[model samples]
Target: MFEIKDNHLAAGDLLAEALAKVPGIRHVKEVNDLSDIDKPTATPCLFYLYYGDQLTDAANAGANMQLKQTWLVVLAERKGSKQAGTNITATIRAIAGKMTGGAGPWQRVNTPIKPKYTNGHAFYPLAFTCQMRFKGALK
Candidate 1:
């Protein structure tokens, strides 16, 4: 018998666990949108936003299917502090060092974009990609 697993959720769980270990990470969670987060008790919060997923390959009859899922790791910090920029940069490097180029489910996609400032908050968006396989139907 074959079973289909919730790989997306699994990936998110793995991400949360890994991100929790990075120093200076105050909060980590999966959010539908970046605006969903209000004022956190701590700075340098990390949010996981599911971007999208696509079928990587067409599955023949009884063959497994492959999917590529993309996610965004947004690092948010309150602006105005002198160490704001340095803190963001250090946290970004820590996250990259811990999450990238490992046997993890996700891989860093590209360079993080410039910070976006809004309402005294600065957000740095980093992209990541993951591959998952769905088992074929049982005969």
Candidate 2:
């Protein structure tokens, strides 16, 4: 068995900081912070990240020592529904660009699907996933 200790916290922090640069964004929160909020505020905009999973490749012996970690990113803009999709999609694209250009700490292993608007929500919400590879010691 192998244990992979990926820098998920650090990665999420960096990603959030990057997103905070988007204009009108009042909230750059983590899932942990969301959990503590009894009543969420109608902030101008908000984004949060949740840790996903770490899975290793069992087929390859070498791959067993490493794992792929994923994060679920949620974006919401309460000000304008029409502009919500555009805002979230642009932010996602910016994150992707950072990965390809080596602007971030971890390698972005996967690309998020195009962001779309959702119904039945007070804010225009979009969800996406980000993946990163993590190496660990083999035993």
Candidate 3:
């Protein structure tokens, strides 16, 4: 499939099962054991997610194009939760190499929707941002 589940929304059981399959265009997995923070009047909650990274640089960079592998960092956080919850993020280093002098060896990274807690599903009010630099661009 072109799109997969996000980390926050993935159920434990579903995550386990998906992991066993050969990743097609996308893959999803939830992570736990992360840090947590307690709210003033809310139950203490932990941060987690189902994450996947794919490389589409080959197609993006044609035979004449140069590929420069570089580390890329992705940060995801809840919009607002008393600002008490710890930010949960996943790092998929060197996802897409640089596109030489061109713009980039473009690619897309997707995170599953947060699960709902009531029906054993939880909502992850999260936002994501990315940072990347080409191989030789940095000093």
Candidate 4:
């Protein structure tokens, strides 16, 4: 998942498009339901990645790049439990690399709070943290 200024689904969608190269990512989904009392306020922007073997393939392709701090969400299916953690971390790094075109002196903005995972039972989701700086409205 890509971090957008607003934390909205649109941003997540855009991120999905930008990260189209990732393999095994069967699909990207926007989750807006906040019924969980423990759930944090939904960022105006966010996306969840549904990954598979293809995701591994895609991540391996981008392993050789340098990426700056970036936000991402990795959702592994129940069956793919074995590789969930590693795949998520690697995929985020790969997406960040691809988004920045493998080169960046991107200014970093430390998030006041660390991004974390929620709905731990089956989803196995993890959120990302990245430094953000802004001068204009993020599209």
Best by TM-score: 1
Which lDDT tens digits does candidate 2 get at residues 49-137?
55455554543455443344455555554434567666666666656536422224333444344433334333333443334444544
Per-residue lDDT of 120 in model 2: 31
Candidate 3: segments with Cα more than 4 A from true spot: 1-46, 58-111, 119-122, 125-139
Question: What is candidate 4's TM-score against the reference?
Answer: 0.40
Which regions in candidate 4 have their CA more than 4 angstroms from the true location? Answer: 1-10, 34-72, 97-121, 129-139
Question: Top model by lDDT, which number?
Answer: 1
- Report model 2's TM-score to 2 decimal places: 0.57
What's model 3's TM-score? 0.23
Error of 3 at 90 (Å): 18
Residue-wise lDDT of candidate 3 within 12-107, one digit each (tens)? Answer: 333233222322213233343222221112222223232322233432234322232222121222334442233222222222222212323323
Better of 1 and 2 by TM-score: 1
Local distance difference test, each candidate: 0.65, 0.50, 0.28, 0.38
Clashes of each: 0, 0, 15, 10
Model 2: number of backbone collisions: 0
Tell me each candidate's TM-score: 0.72, 0.57, 0.23, 0.40
User: Candidate 2 overall Cα lDDT vs. reference?
Assistant: 0.50
Q: Which has the higher lDDT value, candidate number 2 or candidate number 3? A: 2
Q: Is candidate 3 or candidate 4 better by TM-score?
A: 4
Candidate 4 global CA lDDT score: 0.38
lDDT of 1 at 22: 60
lDDT of 1 by residue, 68-123 (tens): 66778777788665666665565455544243323244556773455677777777
